[model samples]
Target: MIDPKLASAAETFTLQCVINKRPVSVDVPPAKRLLCILREDLHLTGTKRSCDIGRCGACMVLVDGKPVNSCLTMAYQCQGKNITTIEGLAADGALNRVQKCFLEEGGYQCGYCTPGMIVTVTALLNKNPEPSMAEIEEALSGNLCRCTGYGGIIRSVLKAAEQGGRRHAGRHESA
Candidate 1:
């Protein structure tokens, strides 16, 4: 029932955005989800695609420094925005404090949800460097981790905060 020309136009738009500190340009359909673009097109598979419905928080990414569900975000809407994924959390081959703490604290199991969890926690720490236990729980409410029971994850976030995570809040690029 759609016009052919209109459909073609919608399928051929360009998206220009910075992802993981690198500028990328892709030609994609207007309705393409950012998750698909990141995983399928850009090959940034760090952003997992578990629940396509956006409830599981498996596709979380940072859009302009705010955490968002990439599965619910349209690729077209990402134009001119800066996106950060789990892969961007390191600098010059050094893991950020959050990531290091997660590993040291055993915050992940099976690793299916680690990337999204890390991304969401990173955003929370950036906004509130020293979030209380309730605040950390509230910020991570959307992200689910089945294997770790979340105790270790909470400890990891707390430990990262204690290690001056705020000092490196906005540093998502390699040095």
Candidate 2:
């Protein structure tokens, strides 16, 4: 029932990468998607999987401080990279400013797209603490949210900026 060539065990490779703030090692096939490696292999389910072809931002994750579609990234390519999933956004028990703003602004509804949206916004705000509406829209163009209607999400980003969240841009202040 299995294709011999595709299921060959000879291709397994040990991948070493930093995840969240910790280092992780995994044995995976070269072609295994980073999405599967994170969700299925590592059991970090906060990074959602939708539209595996990479059109949707549901699988977005921060790779070396930049937002990347995990579905489009290969496991081998992640070697020595710093990968941060949604679960990595918060430190200890407290949420980062971005996460707190999302909650206060009602940025999420179904929650499917929230992680990716937050990931993108985090990267954007880190790079530009005071981004304009146009810049925010352009940065979030890849993330699609069907439930929230974008109003709450926009407000969340704006609120995060207005609150002088630069102190907690990529990491919590206490972190």
Candidate 3:
């Protein structure tokens, strides 16, 4: 049996965090994961929640420009930090290079995992613009794709790094 009183009490807290370059303050539970906060509270559904654990990369998001699993991260952990989701990747309706690459390479199938994959790759490329194939595999090691065997995703990322990355190199500084 669930206790409504307890659940409600557990569902509320004071949260102060920066999301997508905007300062936001809201009341949420301390134990609620950032994934929940983003999807439910802030309404940033781009960050998907899968596996309910860190095993799946569907919940990946940028915390201070580094990839982190939102499902395993508590809302409070995002306090006073900058967080970016797939929605933030495109500025003024312009897709980021990584996103463009994903599209060009058909990096998505079901598209459920694309957001997390894109976020993870963007962070990886930000750290190393010219990462080797091995490095690319290593960087994406944390992400899992049930559809493609990573050949297409890796190729897509490489293409993005080589082409659009140059343009983004001068702008859209990582992190």
Model 2 CA lDDT for position 87: 89
Evaluated against the true structure, the overall lDDT of model 1 is 0.86
lDDT values for all models: 0.86, 0.88, 0.84
Candidate 2 segments exceeding 4 Å error: 1-10, 165-175
Candidate 1 RMSD to the correct structure: 2.9
Q: Rank the candidates by lDDT, best first.
A: 2, 1, 3
Q: Which candidate achieves the best lDDT against the true structure?
A: 2
Model 3 agreement with the true structure over 1-175: per-residue lDDT tens digits: 8799877767567888788878999887787799999999888888888898798799999999899999999977887899888888767778887888889898988888888999999898777777788888888887889988877898899998897566566444543
- Using TM-score as the measure, what is the rank order of every candidate, best first? 2, 1, 3
| Regions of candidate 1 where Cα sits further than 4 Å from its true position | 1-11, 165-175
The pairs that clash in candidate 2 are: none
How do the residues 74-108 of candidate 1 rate in per-residue lDDT, one tens digit apiece?
A: 97789999988888877556787678889999999
Least accurate stretch of 10 residues (summed lDDT) in model 3?
Answer: 166-175
TM-score of each: 0.89, 0.90, 0.88
TM-score of the candidate numbered 3?
0.88
1 or 3, which is superior by TM-score?
A: 1
For model 3, the stretches where C-alpha displacement exceeds 4 angstroms are 1-12, 164-175
Instruction: For candidate 1, report its TM-score.
Output: 0.89
